[model samples]
Target: MTNMLLAVVVGLTAGAALRPAVVALAIPAGRPADCPACSPRPAGPTVLRLLSSGCENCRGQLLDAPWWLPPAATAAAFAAVAAGDATGWYAAAQYWIAFLGTALLLVDSAVQRLPDALTAPAAVGTLVLLAGAAAEGEPGSLPRAVAVAVAAGVLFTAFALGSMGLGDAKLAVSLGALLGWRSWQAAWAGLVLAFTLGALFAVFLLLVQRRSRKSTLALGPALIIGTLAVLATGP
Candidate 1:
């Protein structure tokens, strides 16, 4: 079990590191959008090329860099499910969360300016799983999963309302549901770490004059990365 956990953690880290490539492939520089970096009236192809290959100006603004993300996320989630005791059931849950969560994160952050879709569902899923804990029995019935999930949700909702362009309240539902009440503590801790890192990133961008005080950063990917990192950290 220890060895398996370690392996899963490594895989999660690797997958997260590769998500940018996957996102790029899926969106595939499909359409060109305004980039803050380019000169005024930059050509369509020129901007797309910069985004596809990763323009210096746009850098972290878009997740185009780690297109490997989707596949990598799948790998990490499945690995955790496989390595855990209830292989069939857990693997299924992990697969759905990873796939849906990753896509939702991208779409919402890019299109809606809100990354709540994925996280909210995950938190809800955790609660649903808990309600059925009796039916599932033993392993899945571990106490406090629902509580943890809810708590994490509440905590994030507070943060979301405080500094973002969107409501993060919904995100907690999914994150809580997926993580379960018992495991949510770990989720929050992971969030803290991810946010800290994310803050630093924002600071770095600001320091280099890439981002302005009003420039927003996508929170979904950071949450996803944080959640996975937390899960990876667990015993």
Candidate 2:
């Protein structure tokens, strides 16, 4: 009970910290410099400014991020902590995905693009944290994790030629590494679940006339959700 409450606090605080970055990065590519919604340089402490809403110059709400993000993040963190036996750096890796995946889900849903800025760092950090886990006596093979990540990236790259984006492939590398650290079956399950969820979502949109057959769906959120779901369900 105490640990779950702590997870809630940590997730909320981290989600709040992530808001400014999400607002800044959620813009379409090649527009950050001239984007009207991008907040100006903060005169006060950047952290305080970020935690506050609205652009300082125009007093406009930037990105209009939904109110549920922090609560969703808290739930995700609680789920991750409750779902697995991960400890040490392994546990850190779980929390990393829980928080950062929420950010990615928001950005991708808003802009239909996953910034390399976030994806690249996330992949590297997952790997580094997994390495730390290995060093801390976690019974996982780092080489297997790398191999699974590469394989997942390659598979997703193939899918990118048609239904997905290169960004999704990059995100896969990180998720694959995290899942593979647990077990090969977990990694495979995550991949399958991602595609299945994406397809179901597209169908729902079609049924509701929210999207057309020719419309492109953002796959990042599905992928992130699927990976996190696998982690939250146990290996």
Candidate 3:
């Protein structure tokens, strides 16, 4: 119990430090709505904005932040720490992945965009970390992770060609790798849960907010949320 708490606290602190990095990576060139030219904005100011309890785009417009933001981040950290592998190094890797995923969720929710800078690196890094862990413990899980990631990416690519954003497809690579490392069930659950949650939100928007199908909300965050929820449950 003590170790779990300590790990959770460490994860939380690390996550706080990482929040800025998330913004930096997600928006290497910030998008300010006010700027018609959409000039490139430095990451430092954006990081400051995020730290100072502000999530303004490059245009200095305030973005909508869900009330669950902070608590969700903290919970993600805790869950990563609690449900990660017994190996210390593997657990630490999982914690950082969760932290990064949290940032992606926030940025995607706010801007309806997911930068390739963040998603690509996250996918590569997760695979490397999981591969290393598999060499020590579950060897077969490594191949499974790769297969699932590729399949999921392809699946989401098809979805992207129609309704979803391409970034979400890229993100599926990382999410699929992590969740599928455990089992096919976990991978399927994450994907199903994401669409289910997204559909529910769409309904809410249609009814309460009166948003139309044309004004599609960011689905990456919901997908991330579902994968993280499954990750938190452990196998």
Name the candidate that leads on lDDT: 2
Task: Please tell me which predicted candidate would have the highest TM-score against the true structure.
Answer: 2
Off by over 4 Å in 1: 1-69, 76-91, 108-112, 115-124, 130-134, 140-143, 165-167, 181-185
Clashes of 2: 0
Q: TM-scores, in order shown?
A: 0.57, 0.86, 0.77
Candidate number with the higher TM-score (1 or 3) = 3
Error of 1 at 200 (Å): 2.7
Candidate 3 clashing pairs? 32-58, 32-59
lDDT of 1 by residue, 1-235 (tens): 6746654565566455435433443342345443445566345535454335354445433444345555555566546544444433443454455555556555545553443434455555645555555355534434465555556667766776777543455654555455553354665575687678778768987999677978767666666656555544433
Error of 2 at 44 (Å): 19
- Cα RMSD for predicted model 2: 3.6
Once all C-alphas are superposed, what RMSD does model 1 give against the true structure? 7.8
What lDDT tens digits, residue by residue, belong to model 2 across residues 1-235? 6666677777777877777777766767664322265566444334534545556555466676675675566466656655664668877887887777777888888888888888898899999999998888787778888999999899989999997889999999999999899889888898899989999989998999678899989999888888888887763
**Which candidate, 1 or 2, has the higher lDDT?**
2
Between the candidate structures 2 and 3, which one is better when assessed by lDDT? 2
